[model samples]
Target: MSQSTLVSTRIDKWLWAARFFKTRSLATNAVELGRVLQNEQRVKPAHAVKVGDILEIHHADQVWQVEALRILEVRGSASIAQTMYAETADSITKRQQRAEYRRLHTEPAAQLQQRPTKRQRRQLDNIAID
Candidate 1:
């Protein structure tokens, strides 16, 4: 069969080809959970995707807007994956901003351990009760 004549590929395969998810199953699950959006609309795992489609993928605390550049029937290597989809610059900036904010606002577990003991807790409770 010619390379271009491959039958319709699944959305999960497309997501994997586009490097949206590390595994095909992960992509499928994301689609199933409504975290995968096509043209700003949620799509199903079986959705047929082609080139030039914009996908908004919600991953962790950030959202990714990936523009499809090529279609692949099979999942390619990490190097080839880079050629399939292009991530919008805004998504990268947003993710970086979120990372920076989290780093700045989150307190370390070690510092959180400095909280009061039973005596302090009792004193505070008494104050609240009074």
Candidate 2:
């Protein structure tokens, strides 16, 4: 297939090419799970993705709303992948805010490096019982 001349490609392929997912199968799975939406609507993996189409992708607790700029079937370098889509300004701001919030306030459970000791477990049980 002519990679540069193409006007459209599968949504899964586009996601992979844009580096949104590590592999095409993961992109397909995202689409199937409704984590990937085209123009704010859930789409199939095989849905045609054209230049200028808006896409919302959710993964790893992060969301991105981008406009497709290029249609590429083959995965390439990160720089090349980044050029395939342009993130919306609102999406950029929201992601940055989320990252800042995470940096400022870590999850309470994240401090636990290992499973609780017997004493801790007993205490937890006692607390639950009460």
Candidate 3:
């Protein structure tokens, strides 16, 4: 990379490089859907990115903050990608806790809400008639 280049890269490629998404296209779709922000401002997939920019990426029910350290135009393996940006520890903790909470709470209520199958429904109908 040239001194001035600082490896100027696209937002999608940066997201993938930062290990935010599994693929470049997924990152681009997230940007296009306004789920990615830079400095609190929404950005497009092709947005030019440089070092020190903070990205807020919304994934599922959680958000991730990544501070860019190096920019690259192409995606790399997870280990190499991890070197491109730094993830905030707080965000990871919050996401893990939220996931654990949801996992514990979702099952009981979901079981209650499950509709009866046709056989069960027929049994209920016969019981009511009898």
Candidate 4:
């Protein structure tokens, strides 16, 4: 087998090398925070990841479900990072649908470009009182 095929790395390190997190510390923190799961269960930073392992990662407001395709010990460019995993089709569909849903249903607070003025606040209070 090729060296690439034989290689493996820690889950947290892989996360950093895969560009999932900007730093190893961030990756470790996320793993510790339960934001990263392997096979749907929480994993420690030192847990080694092998190819074909399903990873459920929560980064920012988006969730990713990807299957490990390759493993690496060093962080690389974005293009290289993408080659490490294959995001499932179902995951892609779900994420797209989620984005569309969020777009269609924006938060009320987000709609306001700025905080309400004193007059506007009073009006809002009166409307709430009614």
Candidate 2 residue pairs in backbone clash: none
Q: What TM-score goes with each of the models?
A: 0.73, 0.88, 0.73, 0.86
- Per-residue lDDT of candidate 3, residues 1-130 (tens digit): 6533666788998887777888888999999999999988998888988888888889887788878888776666778777888888987888799889988778533564578889977877898899
lDDT per residue (tens digit) for residues 50-74 in model 2: 9999999999989999999999999
70-90 per-residue lDDT for model 4 (tens digits):
888888899999999999999
- The better candidate by TM-score, 1 or 2, is 2
Ranking by TM-score: 2, 4, 1, 3
- Per-candidate alpha-carbon RMSD to the true structure: 4.8, 3.0, 5.3, 2.5
Better of 2 and 4 by TM-score: 2
Please say which candidate is ahead in lDDT: 2 or 4.
2
Best by TM-score: 2
lDDT of each structure?
A: 0.81, 0.93, 0.82, 0.92
**Higher-scoring candidate on TM-score, 2 or 3:** 2
lDDT, candidate 1, at 5: 63
